[model samples]
Target chain A: MSAFDWLPELLERFKADYVLIHEDAAVTTVGRARVLELDAEDWGRAAGVAAKFNLRWAGGWADQLTDQLGGDKLQINACLLHQGDVLLLRTRVPVTTPVLPSHTLHYPGADRMERHTQDMYGVVFSDHPDPRRWARHHAWGENEYPLRAEFPRMGTRGDMPARTDDNYRFLQAQGAGLYEIPVGPVHAGIIEPGHFRFTAVGEQVLNLEQRLGYVHKGIEKIAVGRDAVGAARLAGRVSGDSTVAFTWAACMAMEQAAGVEVPLRANYLRAIMAERERVANHLGDIGAICNDVGFAFAFYQFSRLREDWQRLSREVFGHRLLMDCVVPGGVARDIDAAAVAQLRAAFAPMKREMRELMPILYDNPSLEDRLITTGFLSESLARLLGATGYVGKASNCDLDARRDLAYSPYDRFKIKVHVFQDGDVLARMRVRADEILISLDLIDELLAGLPNGDVRAEWPMPAAGSEGLGIVEGWRGETLVYVRFAEDGKIARLFARDPSWFTWPALEQLIHGNIVPDFPVCNKSVNGSYSGHDL
Target chain B: MLRLFNKIRKIGVVTEPVMPGRDPAFEEIGEQLHARVGELFSGSLAIREVDAGSCNGCELEVHALNNPYYGIERFGVHFVASPRHADMLLVTGPVSKHMEAALKRTYDATPDPKLVLAMGDCGADGGEFGCSYASCGGVSKVIPVDGVVRGCPPTPLELMKAILALIEKRQGG
Candidate 1:
C-alpha cells in the first residue's frame, strides 16, 4: 500500500466528517465519509468534508479549485500539507454569498493567494486579516468580482474611479525626513505595469509595497466556458514569459483527468521547449542584472546574444516564444532534421563565447560591488514566502519540480540544482547563469537521445466524478493546475496557480533596507510575471 | 577623471552612442557600437530579457529561440537586464493602456544607438489584444521601433533573425 493508505486514520485524528470513502480504485473521501464508489455527489460531499478537516466549502464544484475556500475552513486551508500528494477542491453555492474560511491563518503562504481569490471570485472570507482587495486594485469597483459567472464579458464601466484615490490604501509614511516615492504604473524600461510605493529615508528604503493588477486580463473568467483546446490556448497566454510551463501544467491536469497518455516523444519535446524558455530568460536576466549595476558591456553582449537565440527559435519552434506549441494529448508541430542540425551547429560557439564573457563579469570589481549585497533575502524568508525559480534556488529553497515531483523523463535524468546561502541579487544572478549552462547541457542530452513515437494519444472521456492534479516547476517556480471534467468530457472547472503569486509578495520583503535606486535592480533580479498572477 | 573612470570601468555590453535617439559628445560612442555590432554577426550571444507591456505572445519565442538544441545564444546574441547595459530591446506585445508611459520610459532609459526591435504580431500591429480596451496596440505607438519581428509572437528563429538584422543595420552593413 502507498503511504497515503493511512489517510483515513489521519482524518479520524482530526475528527473530519467521514462522509464517504471510495475503497475500490484508490481510496477517496467525500464530505465526512470514506467509501468505495464512483459517484458525483460523493465527490461534491468530499469537498464539503474538507471543511471538517478545516477546509471551507464555499465555491461551486468544478474540475479544480484555484479560488478561495471561505468561512471556517479558511484557517484549515492555510495549514494543511500532504507529502507526495495534491489537493483539488471546488465549491458551488446556490446563494450569491458564497463563504469560504481564510486559510492564511493556518498556512502563511496562502495569505496573498486567498485575498486574490476573494477579489476575483467574489468569495467572502470572514475575519481574514488584511482583507484589502488584492487583484481588483481599482480595476473593478466594490462587489465587482471579475471572475464571477455573472460578470458581463463586453461591458464598459465608464470612468471607473481611480484605485489609489479611493480603494488601494497605502500605509502612511510619517515623521520628518521620511517621504514616499511613487514610481510607475509607468516605468522607464521595457517591463510590465506594477506600481511601487517606496517609503524611504534619503537613499535607504524603509518599506516598499507593490500594487499590481494594472494589466489584469480576466483570463480565469474567460476559461469558465472554454473547451479543453480553448483553455489550453488561454493557459499558454496566462503569462507570456512562461507559456511553456503554464500550458504544460494545464495539459498535464487535463490529460490526467481524462486518463489520456501523452506520447513519449511529446513529453521529450515539451522538456526541450521548457529548457529553451529557461535559457532565454536566464540569459536576459543575467545581462539585465549586470547592466543595472552600471556594467554596460555584459548587458549589451547578453542582449545581442538573447536576440540571436530567439531568431533561431523561429526556425525550430515556428514561433519564437513557442506559444500554443503545447496542446492536449501532444504538441501542435514537430521539429524537423534541419532544425536539429542548426541547433547542434549553433550551441558550440555560443557556449564558448559565454565562457569567455563569464570571467570578465566575475573579475570586474564594480560588477561584484553592485550585485553582491544588494537585495538580500534570507533563506528562511525565501522558504516561508515560497519564492520559486532562480530567486528561491539562490536563497536555498532546494526544490525543483522536475526532481521534487518526478513525472516522466525528468525522473530518468539527473537535474542539477544550483543553490546559494547568500540569497541576494548576486546569488540569484549566479544561479540563473549556472542554470542556463545546465539547461543547455540537458537539451543536448534530450536531442541526442531523441525518442521515436507518436506525439499525441487518444483522450479518453473522464468519468463524471473523476478529477486530477498537475504541478510543474515552471521557469519561474512550481506551477499548479487542476482539471475536472463533466460527464461528457467537457471542462467542469479549471484553476491555475502561477509562482509569481508567491514571489511578488517576497519582493516587498527583500526590498527592506535596500536603497531606493536599487529597487529596480532587485526587482529585475526576481523578475516575477504580473500576467501570470493576474490571470 | 573619476567620472570618466567610472564610465570606463563598467563591464556589460557597451555599444556606440550611449543613448539612442540622442546625440553624444564623443565620436567614440558611434565607433564602439559599430565594432560591437560587427562582433555579434561573427559570434553568438545570450540575452537576459524583461517584459514591459506585451500580450506575452512575444515572450514565447523570445524564450523558444534558445531551447536546447536550438541554442540561439550560440549565434552571438543575448538578452540583458539593465537599460544602461543592453544592445537592443526585443519588445513584444502592444503597449497597453497602463504600460504606455513605462514603455517610453524603458526606451528612453536604454543606452544610445540601441536597436529597438518590436517582436511578434502584436509588437508590430497590436495582434488580437491591440484593439482591445486594455491595450495601446503596437509598442511603436510609444517608442521608436528599429526592427519589426513579425508573426503572432514570431517563431524563435524569426525573432533571432530580426535581432541579427538589427546588429547588421547598426554596423552599417
Candidate 2:
C-alpha cells in the first residue's frame, strides 16, 4: 500500500546527479527513521523527490557541525513522514556561504521551518518565497546567529534593550474599503503574544499576516548544558498546556539515545497522562469555542469540568499541568490504588455532562448558523499546509500519530481517529468533541489494564555525539522533539516542532474570506499554541 | 428553547463555590507577598494582563481565576481589555526584549496610580530563562512591580490569595 519499493533504487540513482557522501537508515529502539546525506547543491531537489513520493513534510532544522577539524560546516536536516517511519535528508554547507535551494516551493508548511532555521543558524534558502525574519525580532543583531556554538546563550545584548518591533515590512493590499486591523503581541484576553496584521474590506478579511517570535526565550540556546532530566523540564515549559506530551517527547528522545528500555508500566502511565491532558484541553477548548459564540452556559459548565479534571492531575502527579511527570527513564510518580480508583471514578460525571451538552451544542440553530460555513479549510489545502489535530480532521485529513505511527502503549490500543468533510468551524468543534470521548475511553482502558512492574529503568548517560528523535500526538497536534548530546551527555542542541507550526499557516489560509468577528471562534476551534510556536 | 432550558435545569447551579480553597495535596499557600502601592482598587480592581513573554502557564492560572470555582469577579476583580481602563497590571514574563517597547507602551497607557503585580517565578526573577539577547529577564526590569505571586505558576487560589494580599498590603492592613 505504501509503494515505497522504489525508494532505495531511486536513492541509488541520485548518486549520479550529486555526490552521495553518507547514508544509513538506523532502526533504533524508538523506530526506523532513514537518514541520508546529499550534496548541498541539490537540497531542494531532494524535497521535490520526497514530495513526489507523497511523503508528509514533518519539519526542517540545522545542526552546526563543529568538527575537530578546522572545517566550519552546518548540516541541514529535513524530516518527511513515511508510513510509521521518517526519511531524514541531511546536506552540508560551509558557514560562510550557507545557501540551499528552498523546500517551500514543494510544501507550503516548510516556509516557516526553513525561515526559523535561517534566523537561528544563518542558513540561507536561495529561492524562498516571502523570506522575512522569523524568530528574530531584535533578539540579536542581524549577522549574529544564536544557535551557533560561539554565540552566547544570554545573547549579545548589553545594558539597554534593543528596539524589537520596528523596521519590518508587511504586504499591502490596496483596494476600495480595504483597511488593516492589527492585533496582538499583547492580546485582549488571557493568552500568549503574537502580532497579527489583517487587511479587510469592511468585515470580510482579504489578507492575514502574522509576525511571531515575541516569546522565543532561547530554548535551544539554554538547553546546551542541561542533562536529560533538566532538558525534559525545559521541554515541558515549551508549551504549558501540553506539558506531559512535550516532557514525554524529550524523555523519550533521551531514553532512545541512551538505548534504555522503559518499563512497560511507565509507558502505560505515560499514555494515561497523555490522554488525560488531551481530555482536559479538549474540554476547555470546546467551552471556549462555545463562549466565543456568546453561549455563556457551555463555557461555565466546561470550565468547571476542566478545573475539576486538572485538580485531579495536580493531586496525583504533583502539578496541575503535569510538568516533569515524565522523566528521562520513566514517570516521576507511580499511581497508587487510591489514585487509580479516584481517576477511574472521575470519568463518569465528565462523560455524563458531555453527553447532555454535546447534543445541545450541535442542535442549537443560532450557534449552527454562525458555525456551519465559517472558516472553511479545504481537504487539499489541509494536506498542503500539513495541518493536524481538529483542524486537519475537520478537513478530512485523517492522520493521527497515535494510529499511523503506533508506538508503545498506543501500539496495542485501537485508536479511533474521526474525520469530517465540511472543514468549517462546526466540523472542527465536532472533531474536538468526538476526540475527547475517544481519549476518555482510551484512558479508561489503560487504567483498567494497569501493568504491575517497576515504573523506571536506569538511564545511563549516553556517549557524546549520541542523538535521537521523539514524537507524540500532543493535544494541539503532532509534537516532534530532536535532541543531540554533547560531551558529558549534556544537550548540545534540541529542536522541538510544535503542531502550531503547521496550524499557524493553516490559520492564515482558513481566515481568507471569513468575517472579522468570526475569527475568534474559528481561532478557538483550532487553538494554536503561541509559546510553542514562538520557541 | 425548552430543550435547552431542560438541559440547563438538569445540570443546574454548576458555578463553583467562590475562591480557590485548599486542596488535599500540596503544601498550604501560607506565603503573603508584601507590597505598598498606596490604597487603590479599594472596592474594585480593573486588571490589564500583559504577557511580556511567559510560557503561558501563568496565563492559564490567571484565566482560571474567572472560572466558577475561583470566581474573583464575585470579589470585585475584573479583567479589562484596554490598559487605560485598568487600575492594575498583572504581567507575566522573563520579559522578552522584543516585547519591551510594547510592555512600556502598555504601562504608559495605563492611567497613573496603578499597581503592577508580576506573576510567576519568571516575572519575579526571570525563573529558568534569565536575561538573554531575546529576553530582558523579569517584569520589574521592564516595568515597576508592586508585588509578585510566585510559582512556576501559582494556582488559581494562590493567585486569588496574592491579589487579596496585594489589596491588604496596599490598604495598610
Candidate 3:
C-alpha cells in the first residue's frame, strides 16, 4: 500500500472544508506534488491532520499576492511530505490584519518557518510557541517587510540603527551552577558566522539558542524581477556546496512554471552532476568530522580524495564546484564519450582507496570512543524536529527523496537509502560512508547507461500568475523550491528552502547532554548549512 | 594497527611541492614588495578569516589550502583563532549589513601591522549580493583592505599566490 493512499480520506475528515485549486494544477503536477488551497481559519486544523498522519513538515514560505491580484492578501504556503508524495497547503491572509493560526502547536518544525514569514512578509502567526524574530536582523526595521511587494529590491537605505543584535533576549538559565557560553557571530575557524548561546551547568548544556541570520544576503528579495535563467544563477549561490542541487531545483521549478520539458539526456547529466556534488561534499564532511574527533589521518586522506574528485569535476564540467551547470530547460555543459570514460576509469581507484580507509576509521578505538554514543538525538526528537537527510537517516527516519520521489533519471536507478537507529555521531558518520559508496555505484551506472540525445529544450514563457514547485534530494537533504512568474516573464516570488532549516534545530537538540568539547564533532556530523538556512 | 600501517603504505606520499614554479609577474611583484618593505614579517604569518555574507564557496576554496596538496602551514602561514594573534585578516563574502559592524569590530580588534586580504570577487567587490538594503557590499566598505584576490571563488593556487603577495607586503617589500 502507498504511504499517501489515506491522505485524501484524511483531508476530507478535517473540520475545515478545503477547496482544491487547480488553475495551475498542471504546473503543480510537474513536481508530482498535490496543491490545495484552504481557508485561513482551517490552516491549523489541516496541519493537525498532517501531523496526526505522521507527515513530515517539509517547509513554509509566504508570497505577497499584490502582483497577481492588486490587494492586501498574502499567500502563505506550507509543504508536508508522506513517503514520496508532497502535499502543499496554502492559505491567504489580508495585509492589514495579517494574522493566521500557527501550525507550530501541531508540528514544532513550523516554528522557525512561521517566524521567518513574520520577519519577511509581516504575517504574524498567532500563538507561535517562540515568536522571536528569526530571519530579521538590524538591517531592516520592524515596520518594513522586505518580501512584500511595496518594498524595493535595493531596500530603504540607512533607515535603521547599526548593531541592533545586542538586544536579542536569549532564554536564560538562572541557577548557581548555570553560566552562559556565547560563541560567535564571528567564529575562530574559516566558517560562516552564527551565534550560539549555550546555557550550561558543570559542562552539560541546559539550553542552546542559536541566532543565525548573519549571512542573510536578501536572496528572496533579489530573486524577484529576475528572469528564469537569472533566478537559477541566484539559486546556485544559495548554498555554495549544494550548487548543483540548488541550480537543478531552481531550473526544475522554472521549467515547470514555464511548461518546458528538459531532454532525457539533460536529466541524466543533472543526476551525474548532483551525484558528483554529493560525493565531493560527503568526502569533505567525513574528513571534517574525523578532524573534529582528532583523527588527522582520515582528514588528510579524505581531503586529498575530495580534492582529486573536484579536480575531475572541473576537468569534465568546467567549474570546480559545478556552479551554473544546471540552467533552465537543460544543463549549461555536456560531457563527451572521453569524459565518460575518464569518470568510469577514476571510480575504481577511488572505491578501492575508500574501502581501504573505512576499516581503519571504524576500527580506531580512540575515534570510536569520541564519536560512538556522543551527541545522542533521540528518534522522537528527530521526528519532532522534522529532520531529513543524513541526520534523519541516522535517527532511523528513512526517507530519501531520490529513492522515494524518484524524479526523472533517478527513477531508472536502484537507489539505496541507508538508515541507522543509533541517533548518534557515529551513526551519522556511517550514513555518510554508506551514502558515498552508494553514490559512487549510482554514478558509475548513470554514466554507463547514459542516453544519447540533445541536452536542452527551448523554454516557452507561461502565462503570468503560474506557479511551480521543484523538489530535489540535495547533498544535505531535500531542497524544495517554489517559483511564480510575473507578467513581465520575471520571477514574481521564489522561495528556496534548504534541508538545513530542519537539521540545524536537530543540532541544538543533539548537543544537550554532550560536553562543550563534543559540540564541534556533533556539529560536523550534522554539518548544517548556515548560509542556506539564513537565506 | 598493523592494518593501519599497511593502508598507509598502500596510499603512498600524496603531498605536493608548495611552489613548483612562481609566475614571472608575481616574482617581479614579490621583489618590488621585498625591496619596498624590508622583512616586516621575519618569521610566520597568522591569519584570521571572517565570512561577511558569502555563499561559503570561497571559504571552501580557502579551506583547500590546508589539505595535503597545498599544506599552507609548511610555508609559515597558519590560521589563528584570535584577531590579536593574526598578522592578516582573510575576509570572504559580500559584506552583509548584519555583519558590517561585526566585521569592523573584528578589524579593529586585530593588532597593527595587519594585512587585510579580501578573498573572492564578493570580498573584493560584491559579486552577486551587491550593495543593497541587506548588504554593505565588499570588505573595503567596512574595513580597509591591503590586497584583493579575484574569482567567483579564487582557486587554492590563486589564494596561495595572493597570500604570498600579502606576505611580501607584510615584510615591508
Candidate 4:
C-alpha cells in the first residue's frame, strides 16, 4: 500500500489527534505532499508512533515567533519519512518558557538537532540525553540566542581572547589505559575545521566525540531579510561542493512559495547540473578515499578525471562547481544543442576510464585490507541515526529522494539507487562508484531528451506568511530547504538542512572499536560537510 | 598491474604546459617574480593550507593544484601537513569568530619568513558571511595576509600566479 493510504490509519491507531491534514498549497501549485500538523502535547508520543511505524527521521529545525504576530513563542518543526511521503510535525513553546519534550528518546538521530535548536533559539528540550551545547562554541554570549528576531545581523564586536572554547567538558572514559587524542578545529589538510576528541586505550578507540560549529558564519542569521533570489545565492554556498543541490533546493522552495512554474527545459537542465555535480563529487571522493588508504595510483587517475569533468562543467555551466547557477523560478544558464552534444560525447570516454580504474581498486589486496570491515556501522545503528545518502545506503537504508521521493524531471527517469548491506568503508566506496556510473547514465538520458522552451518563469511575490519546503537529492544525500516569505517580499526565514546533519553523528558511532590509524579512511568514507553541518 | 600499465601507456603524459596567459596583470606579476627569484624559490616552496570558514569551493580549486593538470609540485610548490615545515600559509574563508584563535595559532606556528596568501573573495573580503555575530570578517581580520587572490573561487591558474607573486614579494623584500 502507498504511504499516504496507511499513515492516517496508523496515526489513528496510535491515538494521534490530527489537527489538520492539509495539502502543501503554499509551495507548489500541483503535486503537494500531505502535511500533518499534530497537538503539541503528543509530540514525543507521535515520534514514538512514527518510529514504530518504520518512518525515518528526515530532519528537524526551530523558528522563533515574533511578538508582532501576537505570540512570543518558538515554533519547533520536525520532518519524518515513510517511503516517499513526508510528514511534517510542528509544536510550539512560549518565548518566556521555551521548553518541549525531546524526540531523541524515540528517534536517536534527533539528538544533535535538538541541541542545535536549543543553542541557536534557546528552546530547551527537556529530557534531552546530552544537554551540552552542540553548535554554540562561545561564538555569541551565553544568554544571546542568535536566531531570535531581536538579535542583530551584525553581532557585537567583542575583545574576548581567542580559544574561548578550551573548557568544553567532553565525556570522559575512566580506565587505566585510557587517554584522549584531541584533533583539530584546524586540521592539517585543505579541509574545513572541526574538533574531534577520541578517547582511546592504545590504538583502539573507546569512544569518539565531535565538537563542530567551528565554521558557523551566521548563514541563517544573514538570510533573514534577503529576497528569494538573494537568499538562494547564500544557500548555494552552504556547502560549496553541494552548491547545485543546495541552490536547486532553495530555488525550488522559493518558486513553490512564490507559486512560480519553472519551464520544462529549466527542470531538465537542473537535472543535468545535479547529475554532473554528483559524478564530480563521487570521482573526487573515490580518489580521496583511495589516497587516505595510501593508494596513490588510484588517487592520481581519479583526480585527473575529476579535473577534466570540472573543466567541462566550467565550459558548459558558468562556474566549475555550478555555484549560483540555480535562481528562483529556474536556472541561471541553459545549454544549447552543441553543448548538449559535447556533454553526451564526453560521457562514454569518462565511463571507460572509470571502468578501467574500478578493477584495480577492487583487486588491490592492500587497499581491500584497509577498507573491508573497517569502520563498520551496523544497519540497526544506521537506521536509528537516520543516516541517509551513501552513508545510509551503504548500510542498507534504501531511501533515495530521486527514486523514493521522486520529483519533477527525476520522476520521468528510472533511477537506480545503490544500496549495500555491509556498512563498511568498502561498501561506501562501492556505493560512490555505482552512483558515478548511474549519474553518468542519468546525464546521458537527460541531455539526449533535452526539453524545449524558456528556462525561466515570471515569479510573482509570495504573500506574507506563505511557507514552502523544497527537497532534493544532493551528492551527499537528501537536502531539504524550508522558505517562508515576509510581508515586504523579503525572506522571513530560510532553513537549509544538509544531509550531513544525520551522518556526522553516525561518524562518531562507526569509529568505535576501530584503530586510531584507520580514522582517516573511516572518516573519509563518510566525508561529512563541516560547513553544511555548521550552518 | 599489467592492465594499469597498459592504461597508463595509452593515456601518456596528459599534463599541459603552464599557459601564463589568462590574466595580463597576473602574467606581468609572474614575470616580475620570475625575474626576481628565478630558481631560488623554485622546487623549495612548501605551503600549509587553513580553511578559516570557507565553503570548500576554494579548497576544491586548491586541491586541483596537485592534480596532473596544474601539477604544482613541478614548480616545487607542495602542500605540507604541518605549518612548521611550510614557507607559506594559504588561508581561505571569512574567518569565523570561533576559528579566530585557531587561525592565529596556525600563523604563529608557521615560523619566520612565512608568507600568507588569502584566497577567494571570502578570504579577501568575507564574501557572503561578512562581519556578523559568528564571523570576524576575512582572513586579514585574524591574521596578516601578504597577498590576495580574488574570485568567488579563483581558478587554479589564478592561484598559481598568486603563489608566484608572493615568491616575488619575498625575494624583493
Candidate 5:
C-alpha cells in the first residue's frame, strides 16, 4: 500500500468527506497531490488529526467564489504533508458570513497564512490567535475584500491612499529591562521591505514579530481575468529569485489542466534553468551571510561568482534573472549546441571556486563559532512550522520535492537530497553549499541526457472551470502555485505560495534567545523572501 | 587563511577599468559621471535605495554595483544605510500602497538638490502590476522622479548609465 493510505481512513474516521482530486491520472505529472473537499467542521478537526498523525502543515489559502460557480462561497484549502505525500483539505463557507475553525492551536505556522487569507478573502477563523490586518493594511476599505469577485482588480479608489498604519500591535515582553527594537519596511540593505519588531531583554531577543505586506502590489488580485500565459508571466514575478520555479509551477498547473504532454526536452531545459537559479541564489546568499557576519572577503568572491553566473544566464536564457523563460506549454528559450558548450564552460570555474571556498569556511574558527549554535530550529519545531528546503533540510526534515515528489527530468536521475541535523546557521549554509554542487551535477546530467525534439508543445486551453496545483522545490524551498481556469482561458483564481510563507514564521521562532546582533546572520541564514511573502 | 590569501591574489584586479555602457550617449554619460560627481556632490555620490514594491530583480542588479566587476565604489558611489547621508536615491518598483509613506519619508529625509532616479520598468510606470488599489503606478506618483531607467529590471550597466544620465541632466541643465 502507498504510505498515505492511512491518511484518508484517519480523516474519514473524523467524518470528513473526500473527493479524489487528480481524476486524470493518465495525464498526471503535476497532479500527484491528494485534494479533498470536506465539511467546514471536519476540515478544522483534520488539523487535530494531522497533529496526532504527525503530518506537517504545508500551507493554507482562502478563495472567493462567485454565485455562478454553484453559489457565492468562500473556499478554504489547507495542505498537510506526511513523508512525500501532499494532502490538501478543502471546505466552503457561505460568502455572506464566512467562518471556519482555526488550525493555529495545532499548527503554529498557520498564524500568518490564515490572517493573509482572511485579509484577502474576508473570511474569519473562529479561534484565530492573532487577527490583526496583514495584507489588508489600509489598501481597501475596512469591509472591502479585494479577492472577492465583486471587487475590481483596480479598486474603487482612483488614487493611492496615505499611510497612517504605524500602530501594528506587536506582543511586547513584560518585566524590567525589556525593550522593543523596530526594524524596517524599508531595510538598510538592498533588500525587499518588511518590518521586524524585536522584543529583547538586553542583548538577547525575547521574540520577533514580522510586519510584512509592504510589497503587496495586488499581484493575486491583478492575476484574475488574465490568460494562462499572462498569469504565468505574473507568476514569474511572484518571487524574482525563484522565477524559474514559480513559472514552471504555473505552467505545470496550466499544462495539467490542459492535459498537455510537455516535450521531454523542454523538461530538461526547465531543470537546468531551475538548477542554475538555485546555484546562483546560493552563491549570492553564501556571500551575503558572510557579509552580515563581518566577513567581507567571501562576500565579494561569492557576489562575483553570482554576477558571472547571471551573465551566463542572460547569454543563454535572455534574462539575467531568467524571467519569462518558462512559458505556458513549454519554455520560451531553447539552447543551441554552442550555448550548451558556453554553459558547461561557465559552470566549471564556479563549481571549482565553490569547492575551494567551502573548506575555508569550515576551517574558519570565527565563522564556525558564530554559526555553529546560533538561530537553532529543532527538527520538531521545523516540522511544526512546516519548514521546507534548506531551512527544513538544515533542521533534519530531510525531504526534497525533487526527490520526494519525483517530477520529470528529476525522475530520470537519483537526486541527492542533503540533510543536516545541526539546524544552525552553519547547517543552513552547508545545505546551500552542498545543494549547489548537487544542482551543478544535475545540470550536467540534464545537458547530457537532453532529448532531441521540439521544445514547445502547443495545446488547446482546457475548458472553463478547470483547476490544477503546481509545487516545485525552489532555491529557498517549496513553491506552490494553484490555478483555476475561467471561460476564454482567463484565470478565475491564482495563488503562488512563496517558500517564504512557511519559513518566514520559522525565522520568528528561531530568533528567540538569539542576540540582537546575531539576528542578521540568523536572518541571512533563512533569507526568507519579502517580495514573495508579501505578494 | 593562507589558502584564502592565495586565492585572493590569484583573483586580483577583477574589476573592469571602465564601466561599459549600452550606447554612445550612455558611454558619454558614464565618462562624465565621476567629474560630474566632483562638481555636484564633491567627489563622492551616495545613493539610498528604497524598495517601494518589487520582485527584487532590480535590487539584485543594483547590489551587483558593489561586486568586484562593477566596483561602483571605485567611482566613489556609495550605497548609504540612511537617506540623510545620501546625495541621490536609486529607488526600485512601483509605489505599493503600504510603502507610499515610507518612500515619501525617505525622499523628504534626503537633503534638497537630491536626485531621485527610478530604476526598472515597475519604478518607471508600474510595468506589470499597474495602477491598482495596491500599486500607485510609478515612483513619481509618490515622489518627484529625476529620471527613469526602464527595463523589466535594467542591467547593472543600464542602471549605472541611467544614474549618470540623470546627474548630467539635472546639473547640466
Candidate 6:
C-alpha cells in the first residue's frame, strides 16, 4: 500500500474510537487529505471526547469525526479527511431525526454549516441557538425535513397538517408610529413566493423581515436511494438557474467518496458548463437588478442579451439551460469541436455589446440614484453572515470556493474573483455585471486549451460505509453538499446547503434602515435561491 | 438621454408583426412593446407560476428571467408588483394550497387581456409536487390558462419562447 495506508495504524495509535468499517487504498488529495475510510457512526461523540481530552490530531485531522449517522449505507454516506494529521468527519444521512451534535464547538465553519444541515435535512442541531426555521419558514410546515430517508417519494404522500395560527412573534419595533407593511408571500411580478414584513415609520424602514420557503420540493429526501447517476439528476434541479454548479459539486463529492477518478476532459467540460452558467446568471441578474429600479432600458438590453445567451446554450449544449448535462463521474454530454468554435464566435459580439451597455448603466443618473447607497452591509456583517457568491464579494469577503477553496480544474485555472467594498445594491449589481465579463473570458480560455480525452469515467462502486463532502460556488453563493452512505452504498443522509441560508437571514438584516420601496431592489440584488436552501 | 439612445442602439432593432388578443388595449400595449422591447416580449401576458410545494426550482429561473437575463421590460411588459399591473399571469410550480390565495389575488388583480402562462411541469400539471392534498393541481383550476412551458422548471429560453408565442397569439397572427 502507499504511504497513506498508515492511516489505520495511526488511528489505533491515537486511541481514537474508530471501528474501521472499511478502508480503501485509493488516493484523492488536493492539499488536505487523501484516504477513504469508514468507522462506527457514533465516531463523532468519541471524537468530541477526544477533542475534550486534548488528543491533538495530526494536521487538524481530529475534527472530521461524525457523531451521529442516519440513512442506509446503500444511500447513507460518511467521509473522513486526514492530511498529515487533520481529520474532518462528514456524513450524508437522510432527514430523519437528523440529530447531529453542534460541530461549531469543534469547527467554527460548522456554525452556519450545522444550520444548513438542519435546514435541508430537518436535522436537529443539539443546541443551535438560532433555530428559527432556516429554509422552511414560509414554504413547508414544521414536519417537513427534506433529507430524511423515510420521506415519501411520489411527492409527500402523507396528509398535510392543517394550517395552524403561526405563533411567531414579530420582533416588536420600539419606535412610535412604526407600522408593518407586509409585501409578499405573493407579490406584483412573476416572482417566487416569499413574505416580506417591513416595519416602517412612514417611508423609512425601521426593520424588514423576510419569510421564504414557499417552494420547498423535498429534493434531498428524493435523492436518497438514488444511485450516483440519479443523484446528479436531482442535483441539477436543486436550483434550476445554476444547474451545472450544483451537479458538478455533487459529482465531485460523490466521485471523491467513491474514490473514482474523472477524465481530464470531463473536468474541463464541467468547468466550461459552470462558466457558462455563471455568465448566463450574471447577465440576467445585472439586467434584473437594473429593472428593479425602474431602469427599463437596462432591463430590456440585459434581458435581450440573456435570451440570446440561453439560446446559444440550447444550441451548443442541448437543453436550453444546459440542465442534466453534468452527470456523476463525468458530464452527461460533451461539447463538440464545432460547438466550441461557435461559442468562441458568440462571445466576441456579446462582449462588445456588454462593453457598450455597461457605461450607459454606470452613467445613468436615475438608476444610480436608486442603487447608490441602498441596502448597505458592512464588511463585518457580511463575514458574520457568511454571504457567498457576488453578495459576499461586494461586501469585501474575499472567499470563492472556486478560488480560495480551489477544487478540480478550478484549482488548475487561476479564477479571477471580482471584489468590492461598497456592500450596497449598486455594488452587488456591479459585481455581478463584471463577473459576467470575467466568466465569458474564462470560457474562451477553457475552449482554447480544451482537454482531448474521454468525457465520462466509470465510477467505481463505493465500499460500504464511505462518505464525502462537496462545496460549489453557485450563482447566488456557496452551495455545500455532504453525502453519507450506508454499508451498501445507499444514500443514508444527503445535506445540500444552499447559499440562501446565510443570504436569506441577511435579507432581513439588510432592509434595516432602507425604505419599504427599496426592498425589492435590494432583495433582487442578492437573489438567494430558496429551493436550493429548502432541499 | 444619450445613455438611453446608446442602450437602444446596442439592443439592435426588430421589426416583427404584433398579434391581437381578446382585448384591444392589451393588443396595443403589445404593439408598443414590439416597437420598444422587441418581439421576444411583445404582447399582453398573464403569468401563473405554481409552487408545487417546490424546492423552488422554477422560481429561481423565473426570478432570473425577470431580473436581467430576460428582463421582461423594454417591451412595455413589467412584472407588475401586483397582479393588477399584469395582463398575463405566469405560474411556476405544482400549485400548493399555501400559495392558492396569493396566486388567486395575483391573477384576480389583473384586468382583462390577461393570458395565463403555466411556466413549469408543476404548473402544467402537478409535476413532482402533484397528488398531495397540500397541492391545488394546475394553474387552470385556479385561473384561466393561455399557454404552457413545460420542464421541471422550463429554462429561461423556453420561458421566452412561450411568452413570445403568447404575444403572437394575442395579435391573432
* TM-scores vs. true structure, each candidate: 0.74, 0.95, 0.95, 0.95, 0.96, 0.76
* Ten-residue region with minimum lDDT total, candidate 4 chain B: B29-38
Question: What is residue A504's positional error in candidate 4, in angstroms?
Answer: 1.1
lDDT of 3 at A298: 89
Task: Give me the runs in candidate 6 sitting further than 4 Å from their true place.
Answer: A1-127, A133-165, A487-489, B1-4, B15-80, B83-89, B96-117, B125-149, B155-173
Extract clashing residue pairs from model 2: none
Best by DockQ: 5
Estimate the overall C-alpha local distance difference test score of candidate 5.
0.85
Model 1 chain A: weakest 10-residue lDDT segment is A72-81
Ranking by DockQ: 5, 4, 3, 2, 6, 1
Error of 3 at A52 (Å): 0.4
Docking class of 6: acceptable
* lDDT (tens digit, per residue) of candidate 1 on B22-63: 334222333443355457534433232545456455554454
TM-score of chain A of 5: 0.95
lDDT of 6 by residue, A148-190 (tens): 3344453353434324225555566766787888766665555
Instruction: Report the lDDT of model 5 for residue A230.
Output: 91
DockQ of each: 0.14, 0.66, 0.70, 0.74, 0.79, 0.29
Residue B83, model 2: lDDT of 95
Write the residue-wise lDDT of candidate 5 on A1-535 in tens digits.
Answer: 4756776566555554342333333432226667666678655667887787787787788776776765888889887777778777778899998988899889988988899888888888988888888887777787888888888878877684756467677786688888898898878888899899998898999989988999999998999889878998999998788999999999998888878899989999999999999999999999999998998889998998998899889989999999999998889978999998888886678788987888988888988888898999999999888889999999998888898877887888999988999899999999999999999988988887788898999968688877788888899988888888888888888888988888888899899989999999999999999889888
Question: Residues A168-235, candidate 1, lDDT per residue (tens digit)?
Answer: 78888789899999876645554666788999999999999888766665555556556678778878
Query: Can you tell me which runs of candidate 3 are displaced by over 4 Å?
Result: A1-4, A15-30, A67-70, A159-161, B18-39, B169-173
Which scores higher on lDDT, 3 or 6? 3
- Listed for every candidate in order, the interface RMSD values in angstroms are 8.1, 1.3, 1.3, 1.4, 1.1, 5.1
lDDT of 4 by residue, A446-477 (tens): 99888899998987988887788899999999
What lDDT score is found at residue A259 in candidate 5?
80
Cα lDDT, model 1, residue A198:
92
